[model samples]
Target: MPVDRKSLFKRVPSGIPGFDDLIEGGFPENTTVLVAGGTGTGKTTFAAQFIYRGAELYDDPGVFVTLEERAKDIRREVKSFGWDFKKYEDEGKIVIIDGVSSSVGLPSEEKFALEDKFNVDNFLRYVYRVVKSINAKRLVIDSIPSLAFRLAEERQIREVLLKLNTILLEMGVTTVLTTEAPAPQEGRISRYGIEEYIARGVVLLDLQERNIELKRYLLIRKMRETKHSMRKYPFEITSDGIVVYPSGEIY
Candidate 1:
């Protein structure tokens, strides 16, 4: 069947206090964006807020695929910000997958066999089922790097993610997959070259320390086929949630 042209440019609000304005609205339809940051940089929080906002403001059902943390732990962590994940669950607007599974090592008596290969295949399966069931329009996969590392080989990781993005885009869902960026002084960009290259857009969150004060900056590195805010904008994670400072304050 031919694709529908009406699916294009149907903007969905990001739900972050200050982010939408920076992007001149929100992400384009059916595009996968990479949100990369380090520890304590609010990557998980940002993703949750994005999903939460989608469910509440836009009535768009969403799905969260967690690789490292349990579903309950994620709920508790985000509750501090007053986001009621339980309520969203009750309304059937959100679904959380606990991707943590056990693995066993092979003994000398037995040839090597993966008892539970919790690779991207399993992740993709769960995502496919959840999205199809809910007819979800927005998705978030927190910490794609951890999942890639568990694959234990660069080629395997790249291939899995490349295919994963292709599948998600075909579903016409705007998605964000989180990754950890390399240190700035190294003069390198994201560690996963292929993933970064394949994604339709990339938004980088940077935490900089000056004297005793810590500041946060968000930079849109790339947004193919769309206009994006080029400057490094200031953002904060507070009791309410993430708020992107205006262009004047960012400078």
Candidate 2:
């Protein structure tokens, strides 16, 4: 069997509003994008909305690999936005892998083994099979930091991520990875060094409390082969989902 590397490069339509407009036209044909942010910064909402938009608007089935939450809980939480996860699941459009189960279900006797505990290789293989089966073009890993922490060494983590990104990109699926910032400080967002460099694009989400106003901003730090808006654009998490304002104001 041979992999047609060229077959994986096809334009993917992003369902998010202002976010896509900032980066020319969504992500590249086949690229891995990192969306790193802290808690309460709307990372899951953004990723969910993106995948929902893909299924409902673009007719592309997407896979969401969540490492922290349950699939049912995620559906319930996002229901206020009118994203019917059950409907999508029934229609065979959206699929969620319960990484929480993998992470927590380590042996009672054995403390931990990165692979024994959270085998991302199995996860990737499953995603690859599903993508090929359904011809899926969009994929997301809710958070990669969890996987990184489980790995004992930095080199091993980087090696695994590098290989995963290469294979996923080679498969021609436009992917997004969600990562939590270590702390609310400069250069504290992404710890794994090669994430930003290796990934085709990077989007940073920041939320800060100033006096009494809680402001949220989205910055397109890097996007290889594309001209992107470099401003820290204001955004909000609404009942309808994430909305990035035209001007730097919370609308």
Candidate 3:
């Protein structure tokens, strides 16, 4: 008898509307995915939605490690989308890990705060401890470029992320690691140009001049182990959150 490899993995439903169908119902379990985009491309919203929807709808706990914005600011920002991150955090369904306060030498009001932002090992251990505490099933590390600021060399950055990937896999969680991508480039996908290779999947969100307007689009540049859409699909940021039109195409 032949073996079905994909059947060995379970799908981790992405919370974004119309998004999961494109990726075969969701991201693969126990894999780290990279969400890369330029400014105003809704990278944060997509990643946040993954954490928020996982906790609220699926009964899956999540950990959102904000690297760019403070935890309170993120909570407040996502409130407009009707996704109450703080509410879930309060209920122990999710954790908003404050990576910002430690970077700027400030005290975070959030329950979880990284004590040392400069040491990659310390940051990874802190995340490990918090994720285990909640038994979280989904994880998001917003904007890896901010994390790059903590390290002095690209080698160290890659090594740290590889370690982080291993940590996420060991915990059996589907993770979304966000990073900033430069504007409409030919080949450059991420700010540091090294993040795409570190994760098992890479999703790109971009804005393009289409149909006489600047339309937002999303593409799965690469997703290892599972068949996924290769076309640039249209998406929007609504009051509810991001919604991907899997059937719609751009260009």
Candidate 4:
């Protein structure tokens, strides 16, 4: 009797092993997801894997926009997991857009560095060109808070998020955006407090000390279409990448 809206849209696999099961095969195609976490909580890995594996497994090209960290640094970090980001770049499977150097008044060596950083309009145009060039199906914005340096007002930040989401969706690219989540005591899931509102899904990574042992946990706080677990799920950063135990609960 009820309609299944999910049937109306196709799903794109998240590309992270064991992570797709939590979201019913994958994310709704072309939707935006926000991945929030504190320092060293594996947010970067999660987002990178989404881009890498999407290209590796599903033949989905991707665009990774590094707003805070250098694209090379992110590449080096993910290389420990055996992912050769350079190979993908060479093969035209992935584009690592440098958004950092311009923001810092330095010239970028990246092939896809942004000419005008912190300007949402410029960023969107660059994204459009890159996505079109690669026919990218997935995209990533490393951290939303980094935009705060130039966008001093909350309204401006929110508008940037909205425009980013709208542009990404219009381009038909499944996007995963990363942001810093303050500590549990801060009472906010995202640094800006508005990133989650503009996304179709929100996955928060948390590092908590339990029984004197530090553990990594993931929570699917909000997803628009598919049924997802609200309970925090146990995850780990193994030699490969982030692995989420869909059935395991933190309790």
Writing each residue's lDDT as its tens digit, candidate 3 over 46-67 gives 9999998998889999999998
How many pairs of residues collide in each model?
0, 1, 0, 0
| Weakest ten-residue segment in model 1 by summed lDDT | 106-115
User: Which model is ahead, 2 or 3, in terms of lDDT?
Assistant: 3
| Model 1: CA > 4 A from native | 1-8, 101-116, 152-154, 248-251
Residues 1-251 of candidate 2: C-alpha lDDT, one tens digit per residue? 78653344445656777777776656777788888887888888888887898999988888887766766678789899999977976787877655565567643221111234445576567668767766777888887877676566645878888788888877787888888666644555476756776678888899866678889989888887676777888888887898887565642
Where in model 4 is the C-alpha error above 4 Å? 1-8, 116-118, 152-155, 249-251
Whole-model Cα lDDT per candidate?
Answer: 0.77, 0.74, 0.86, 0.86
What lDDT score is found at residue 180 in candidate 4? 91
Clashing residue pairs, candidate 2?
Answer: 8-172
Where is model 3 more than 4 Å wrong at Cα? 1-7, 183-186, 249-251
* Top lDDT hit: 4
Error of 1 at 99 (Å): 0.7
Candidate 1 residues 19-94, lDDT tens each? 8776657887788888888777878888999899899889989988776676778889999999998898788888
